[model samples]
Target: MRTVFVQIGEIMTRTPVLVAGAGLSGLSTAVFLGMHGTPALVVERHESTSTHPKARGQQTHTMEALRLVGLEDAFVAASPKSRGFALRIAASASGPVFHEILHDTFVPMGHLSPAASADASQEAAERLLLGRARELGADVRFSTELVSFEQDSDGVTAVLRDLRTGEESTVEAEYLVGADGHRSPVRTALGIGTHGSGSIAHNVLWGIRADLGHVVGEEQVLYYLQNPELSGGTGVLVSTDDADRFVVGVGFDPDTQHLDDFTPERAVEQIRIATGVPDLEVEILDRAPVETGMYVADRFSSGRAHLVGDAAHTMPPQGGMGGNTAILDGFYLAWKLAAVLRGEAGPGLLDSHDAERRPVGEWIATNQYRNAMVRTGARYDGPPPVEDPATLFFGYRHNGAVVSEPGDEHELLEDPNAPTGRPGSRAPHVVLDSPDGPLSTIELFGREFVVLTGSEEWERAAKSVAADLGVRLTAHRIGDGLTGPWAEPYGVSDDGAVLVRPDRFIAWRSPGPGPATDLERALRSVLAR
Candidate 1:
């Protein structure tokens, strides 16, 4: 094992931003701040990488967020290419029922640009992002715990402890961000309350790395089994990067004597029973009992301190929005902090973090609850049944403060049919031709606002706005050969244009009559006017 050490009593001075917790949210936030030339310090209690793969599912929006930071490929590599979701329902009596199968496909680069190719492109993109973050020089401290913090008008002072040496020191920063998990010290210190219900029930998540043989097939599968003694439950089969090792999760409530019991042995037995192949052998690599809970923080920010990731909201694993939402939180907050630190935006810019993110958090909580209800058969009354699984993945619309016009009411969009991109929405992934070579739309985002104008008229307007605002902007025109169906899905015509914020949401759009004056106004509203 390798280690990087920071000297104790060195008295590190104030950075523009101090982030506690170096997990996905903290690291992603630090990377974004660093890219904008704002010094950021991240402290983590853990000494090394966390082996607990609690949250593994990364949605398309999450992938886009990583691309903004230049780590899309690493994330993709870490993630298994899951088409859609498979639902298995267990009944009080009878065998398990396979209820739903959703198929979603990944878009290749050729659709966006001829330069973009599928061969090793995803891997290359991930590595590039990881490397870029490292190059930006973020101060990432591991094995350090944040003991406490004090905030003044000028800056925030934080006390940190070195777990390895048992030494304590204080560092100062202009702002503090809590990217910590559910039990957030910052949330506690700030007296921020979490508003929501407790876990519907406690369930132990048993994870196994095994070769379940080819009978399960390459695609992900869910199995719901019914047993007289044990109500109904579901088991998930997730394909991993390693061909020989497949990750499996089984949910079991301790209160109920489902299957066998809530023990590891019982979990394995349940898997066997659900699969209905007693002869099929599986190797149990690791297992842990996970307490599932759902809650949202009352507020995402207070004064100069802000919360992202689990600190802001926590949802059950049924929906798989925990990690994805955390990543999105990092993206939404990083730029606003950067703007304030750079003196390019006002402090009020930070307020939008709560305004824009809280709605998303609430939506996730509701969706997760719905998913749990569907799995447990708690509430069967709702919209008519649909066969499409993709609807769950891309059907959400951003109806928060960021989205001025959410349009008409609609249910969540199912998978493959979901729109690629829209205003105040996550920017869709598209391959485009750059001077150097092929690039992903995600590759072009981040650090600063990006005005993706499809026409020459909007392109000129983008330049004027970038110049007037004194912000870096990348303006590009959609060429004839570069157009694709994904573009139309975003509701942008060949003559239309879109202004993507530093966070990659469409800040403004135009149909090419002329650049809307409100484009710059909206940027100012979100950034600094």
Candidate 2:
């Protein structure tokens, strides 16, 4: 059968997916879909990827998601050589020996994942993702914009305009993803509302190029230079790709400070004052005319169109959760979309995307807001002292309809340090010796449901069930392949089985031995058979 549709007399170009925006989230979504052979068309208003060095934190969980699709190496190679992040609380960059707050080396908590958290400017990361998307046969069109879209039960029809030629066209797509940044037109058209601390505070960002080698005696990714004595101002001097390039951040008061007056000369003065480099003269590369805020949409989807990235949630730059979380959003939803398109899952499976990611988005927004509060010295009245960052990163669960009914009321988050193979939680990583070489359990996921058991009998049963379903499911016997205490972390017995989703989140589990029919029944329910 032909993989397209027709409307009236026009032969409408039918695509599996339509991605609005060519930024990081949108590009990543296209790349993931293209890799899975799901044709996608991505439209962006901008002529090219961003050159502004905005977000710089690539968290561990985000890296793991990228690694799943063979894109980790590119990120690592482009990211800054930041071993770990440190909040260097100093009187000034050139002076002072105040208390420097440093944390443990950045790694996924409990060694739960094989991928490492990284540091790279958002601009750099986007360039990499955009290339990969185009390489994977994605139809990415720059200087193009999605004017509007009409969603029906079967597909979405989006109006497109070529910004360069004033040409207009209509495209039919199975689904639409609005990866557009904040102030998303798609979300606005869908009438999605956002809630949370609206405008927390205002901060001005200025990019600069200078020699701060002497000022920064030690190598640090971020420097919170607090110099109250300076007549200019104090904020942060963030390292970008090299020592010469940095983005200068400072509080902006619209009432007193006029953006037009804060020119390159003024920015240079602030940089000099903040760094305590008396005669430091630096070029002000660029500055943001607007400010940043924190918020999450009340709804993730409106009919056949769904929002991702800044369209779904906007958070502070703290914890570097902005871009990282957006990337994860694409990774989480990509495989589900592919599965549904391939008819392996019912359309109901798509509902799991919002059920799983919305809460996580809200949580990240809240935490980042709190982190912003602490940074700006604002009174934070939320969770006292803040929850562990680990729980914020790797601990989120998909409490949605895609998984089987939980045996118990599992928490919204699992402890990354001591992961239990519980429903909704991410599957723990363990390395095993395969004929090709050593491979991580995480490496086994991404493309299909994985049923891992310690007992050979359970493994055979899992294989039989998968064969009957004719789904992209597989089984593995960890103990037989020779491994560590694999079953313990999963809270499974020799005969117990753990059913993992394609996204690496647990779908169901048998704490101990159970009948083979029980496994089959659970699988059928989760798959919506």
Candidate 3:
């Protein structure tokens, strides 16, 4: 409902937000910004969306975020329905399975949230996001690059070049988002430093056409082939959305061999050996070398410029967290930037981006790097224990944009199953019966700040505060038109209240009805007003 479509100007250039790189993060930032009534100008150096089935699998947390922009159905329909994912230690798809590291089922998480997890490929996901972003009035241009940008207290001035015409233009924006890839020119211009394990391995990614469904099964498959006969001692094979298409990553030492050394013929032979099937018909569609590494930027924002996705953090794609995290980074920034641009929040609210996302990014990068090392037999201190998937998915907490109770210890993560509804935590999902139909409480956020209460007085206070502050805010009574058992899950009583941010994170909570000034104070603090 917060979606506000502005008329597209023929020669328009200025925007409130200028997003660089049309990857998942940049596109998502543009899409979410539009949803919050602040469409962005998105530019990408590449000519078009990626054709490669690069990253796959959208976790529950990501699905929830995508649902905010009504992308859940499209994404779920685009991907394959899977019982879950399977990671096995084997020579190849056709070879004997040496060990099974993880075999998960997707059905168990049905009650945790309203959105369904998806195995959608990055290629499909990007197309959907681009379409939605444009429909919401975003001006997304391809073959355009962000040449440089300078930011002062008021706004950002950026130079952009058309890759095709080689003509350059200047644009002004209230804020700039650097969603570029790992080698980010925007980040470089910002002088942002990175810290973590650098380039762990060099791998040649090969696109192959083969009927591996019979060998790999229908579920998502991750085959870790430890065959010394391959170029490197190890190799990885993953299944894509297409039944007959697959991606094979073969590692190689840059010191001895190069990407050029792995010719089409050599690649076929290597795939044959890894599959343990001699004379297997295989056609190489494409091949490119990629370097895997672990790194996190020291800062996520600088002045009016900010970083997201690989520009902010880079980690091995062992768990597909990088792509999901990148999308989330965009989601997190969109709302805050929208609020600041609209004068609903102070500029100081933007500073919270680094405090909220950097720690979570570091944890994910470090753990994923450790996981990659173990899977590849690379040296590490030891194989660190992986946190529960649910914890990693929904349990991560935030430190910014929240007014916590005085005694709150501020744990980074909590058991989502035993959600306490503390400030900075994700709002727990609860089924609510309404005139339309049954809906999860998760469906109630994203457009504007929301206050939930069963008390009429609190609802009145919420409405008064919104008018007094001149900000977009909504109040919903639990038992009025909506009937449900939400008080327990929200950690509030019948007369208590819960404040949820636009991103659906709990910003504050009260155990019982409070003075009229209570809700106003909480909103002011959360908005950095």
Candidate 4:
């Protein structure tokens, strides 16, 4: 059938930032731009919210980004707290054995919370973000399709079709962001080619509501079932949100099996066999089959158009990096766009978005492939697990960007036993006494650049620099006994300082007083001062 067209009459005087797609990535970009006083128009082909929870989990970094957009409390309220991830290995004689537990001690939420609470946090966060976006007046047009676009020096003009009304219209915007999914039409229209492999295998994901308390002992469980081929086995077990509900993910060769082969009966049998719980009762809520694949765009930006999230990079879901990476992309791009629009920075600030983020996407893609290999019992052929020092949490670097020092080498500091504040890593999460009560160091994040220092002089210097550069800088004093939980993780005593970017990554840090030149240089680099 020929696609219907929806016309937006009369071009808006304000150069609306046009966004194609209303998925998490598109919604997030629209929200941030709208909050920053920029007008945004987002078009989604889907008629409504996705019934399938394509991305069910959000990483800690995702949480930080949501918090930055003032939606953390809401997100926490919606979803349950995911404290830990457990892997279960299916055995032949013994049947199954609990393998490993990756404690959620990374940051913000930490490992103290239970699985149900974590889930609640996830739900709350999503609701808050969507609601806030609406409140901010983002023009979220659902059931709208982007037919095509033409760009010039002035702006980009896009033709969008309304699926319901069968009308077409044009939208002109100074910038166009393609927050569309992996099969992004904008990327296709831009002639962007993806570099990576397609799904190595097909997997079915289903959510079940059952009182599986007897079968699964933990609040959060991930089972790795053994198949006859010695490839990856089926994945089954309880999710972090609903205690009585479970999510089962199973791998199958789509070339051999048809969709009918993944029926609820077959899925149930697979779950029972994988978990070694023959009598377990599960009520299926929803099911979806997905083909796993990984890919990164050859380029993320072309002129006024840029890609984020799945459009920029599509990774296997093994590491749960998809949503987190997308959110980070939004925050990273938001400030740069703001800087350029407000005349605080030059267009060069936009170049760093791709340079800094592409490496991150590469890292996530590599880790995701590794996780997938581990799941599929493949050769484990992905990049070596980032050395302890470069664990997914802290190992990410901005390279020669804002705060990177020349000749600074990255060392492996993955010491679960080591103190916090290690070099080339995320500053440890700390708790400090706030006027209301105790607050997390993560709470101080978001909005603008934050300089966490111990001395008033340092705080004063930071404020001065911020004023000189026409940027917002928040300085927090790390008082004695004030470090709370963050001291050990951050490796900071009372004498150190940390410069956190708007995106929550550590820009520059020092054990004690140092020349402000580095901080200035880093900010200049990022802001294009």
TM-score of 3: 0.95
Q: Give the TM-score of candidate 1.
A: 0.75
Poorest stretch of ten by lDDT in candidate 2: 1-10
What's the lDDT for all of these models? 0.62, 0.77, 0.87, 0.65
Cα-lDDT of candidate 3: 0.87
lDDT tens digits, residues 1-529, model 4? 0111334366332355788877777778877776666657788898865554445555555656665566756665555444455555554212545444244423343532111112332233434555677777777778999889988867788888989998877776777899888888889989999887666667777777766666554446555555562214555344646677666666766778776877677777766655556766767788777777888888888887889989999998665567667766776787667657766677677777677777778778867777767754667555654423225644465543355545556433344334344333455555577666877776776667788877676777788888888887888876644445443465454566778866665777666676777667767876766
Q: Tell me the tens digit of each residue's lDDT in model 3 across 1-529.
A: 1222333453336788889999999999999988888888899999999899888878888998898889999998998766578888887777777888778744356677878888889999999999999999899999998888898977888888999999888777888999999998999999999999888888888898987766777787888888888877789898787877888888888898878898778999898877667887998998888888988999999998999999999999876688899999989999999899888999889999999999989988888887887776666787584657787788889988899898888878888989899999999988899999998888888778999899999999999999999989999998899999999988889899999999989999998999769999999998999
- Model 2 error, position 404 (Å): 5.3
User: What range of 10 consecutive residues in model 1 has the weakest lDDT sum?
Assistant: 113-122
lDDT of 1 by residue, 164-260 (tens): 9988887878899998888999999999999876676554444556555444555444443334333234444444444455455555666654534
Displacement of the residue 516 alpha carbon in candidate 3, Å: 1.9
Runs of candidate 1 exceeding 4 Å displacement: 1-10, 79-87, 90-95, 103-133, 207-211, 214-287, 379-447, 452-465, 477-498, 509-522
Model 3, stretches more than 4 Å misplaced?
Answer: 1-12, 81-84, 104-107
Of models 2 and 3, which has the larger TM-score?
3
In TM-score terms, candidate 4 sits at 0.77
Off by over 4 Å in 2: 1-12, 81-85, 89-92, 95-99, 103-110, 225-234, 255-257, 384-389, 402-407, 433-438, 479-482, 513-516
TM-score each candidate. 0.75, 0.91, 0.95, 0.77
For every candidate in turn, the CA RMSD to the true structure comes to 6.2, 2.9, 2.7, 5.9
